[model samples]
Target: MKSTITVSKKVKEVLERKKKEMEIKLNKPLSWDEFFQNIFREEEERIPKLTEEEAEILKDLTKEDRKNWRIREFV
Candidate 1:
C-alpha cells in the first residue's frame, strides 16, 4: 500500500533547502527519512532524563507544592 500527501510548493521548497543545508552541515547526503530521523534523535537527546529520586519526588508532591510549581490537573 502507498499513501499520497499534499504540501504547498513553498513549504516543499523550504524543506528542500533545509535538506541541502543539513547534507552540507553533516558532510553527507541524506534520504528524506534520514533527514527527519536525525532531527528527532537530536530533540530526544535534548530532553532531560529523570532519576528514580526525581521521579519519586514528583510523584509525592502535594497539591500545594504542585500549585506553587504551576502544575495543573484537569478533573
Candidate 2:
C-alpha cells in the first residue's frame, strides 16, 4: 500500500502543518490511517449519512419519529 503522488511544496507544507495542528488539537499524534479516517469519516452517525440536500425530500413523519430524529442526542 505504498504509492506516491506529486504535490506542490506549499501543499505538502500545509499538510504537515495540519498534521501538527491535529496532533495538538486531539492531544495525540495520529497514525496515518487514523489521521485519514478522522479527516474523511462521517462527522456523525445519527443522521444516516444523508447530506442536507438529501434530507429535504421527506414528505411525512410521525410525531415520535420527528421528535426522535437527531444528529446526536446528549441525553
Candidate 3:
C-alpha cells in the first residue's frame, strides 16, 4: 500500500536538513524506527550492573525512611 499527504514547504525543508544531519552523524541514513531502536539499544547497553549492596539498598527502601538504621549490619 502507498499513501501520500501534503506537508508545508518549510516542514519538508526542515525534514531534509534533519535527514542530512542524521546521515552524517550515523555514517549512513536510517529510517525513523531504526534511529529510535539504535538509541534504545545504546541506552540499555550502558546500564551499570548492580552490586549486592546496591541491590539490598534498593530492596530495603521502604515507604518511609527509618532513623538510626545500621547500613553495615545489613551488608
Candidate 4:
C-alpha cells in the first residue's frame, strides 16, 4: 500500500536538508528511514556495553521492581 503523511513545510525542509547532508556525508542518498536508521545505529554503537557488575545490578533492580504477579488458564 502507498501512504502519505503530513508535516509542516518547515519540518519537511529541515528533513530535506538533513537528507542532503547525510547523502554527502555517507557518499550516497538514502531514504528518510535509512538516514534516520543510520543515525540510530551509529548512536547505539557509541553506547557503552554493560559490565558484568552493572548487568547483574540492573537485573536485580528490575526483579525487585516487578510487583504484579498473574497466572492464566485457558480452555
Candidate 5:
C-alpha cells in the first residue's frame, strides 16, 4: 500500500538532497520509505541500552536520586 504525505517546499528539498547524498554514499537507489528507515536505524543505534538490573534500579529511584543521577551522568 502507498500513501501520500504533504510537506513544506523547504522540507521536501532537504529530504531530496539528503536522499541523493545517502544514495551516493550507500551506492544504491532507495525509495522514500527506505531512506526514512535508514535514518531511523542510525538514530536507534546512537541510544544507550540498559540491562534489566539497570532498569530496575532506575525504576526504584526517588526524585532526589534521579536528580542526582542526572547531574552525575551529565557532569
Candidate 6:
C-alpha cells in the first residue's frame, strides 16, 4: 500500500538532500520509509534508558521533583 503526504517546498528540498547524502554514505538506495526508519533507529540508540529501580523511584516522586530531575538529566 502507498499513501501521499504533503510538505512545504523547503522541507521537501531538505529531505531530498538528506536522502541523497544518506544513500551515498550507505552505498545503497533507500525508500522514504527506510530513510525514516534509519533515522528513528539512530535516535533510539542515542537516548538513555532507566533501570527498573530508577523507574520505580521516579513513580514515587512529586510532579515538581520529576520535572526537576528530567531537566537535570537531559540538560
Best by lDDT: 5
Between candidates 2 and 6, the lDDT winner:
6
RMSD, every candidate, angstroms: 5.6, 12.4, 9.1, 9.0, 6.3, 7.4
Candidate 5 root-mean-square deviation in Å: 6.3
Tell me how candidate 6 scores on lDDT.
0.90
**Candidate 4 lDDT, 1-75, residue by residue in tens:** 657899999999998998899899989979878998988998999999999999999998888877555566798
Model 1 Cα lDDT, one tens digit per residue, 21-45: 9999999999888998988998999
List runs of model 2 lying over 4 Å from the truth.
42-75
The models' CA-based lDDT, in order, is 0.88, 0.74, 0.75, 0.88, 0.91, 0.90
Error of 6 at 15 (Å): 0.3
lDDT (Cα) of model 2: 0.74
C-alpha positional error of residue 4 in candidate 5 after TM-score superposition, expressed in Å: 0.5
> Which candidate has the top score in TM-score?
5
lDDT of 4 at 56: 100
Provide TM-scores for the models: 0.69, 0.52, 0.40, 0.56, 0.73, 0.68
After superposition, the stretches of candidate 6 with alpha carbons farther than 4 Å from their true spots are 57-75
Q: lDDT of model 4 at residue 69?
A: 50
Question: What does candidate 6's lDDT look like per residue over 1-75, in tens digits?
Answer: 999899999999999999999999999999999999998998999999999999887776765586676434554
- Candidates 1 and 3 compared: the better one by lDDT is 1
Work out candidate 6's RMSD over C-alphas. Answer: 7.4
Backbone clashes in model 2, listed as residue pairs: none
Which tens-of-lDDT digit does each residue in 1-75 have in candidate 2?
Answer: 987889999998988888888889999998767776777663554446666665555433454478887798689
Give per-residue CA lDDT, model 5, range 26-66, as digits (tens): 99999999999999999999999999999888787765486
For model 1, the superposed segments whose C-alpha errors exceed 4 Å read 1-3, 62-75
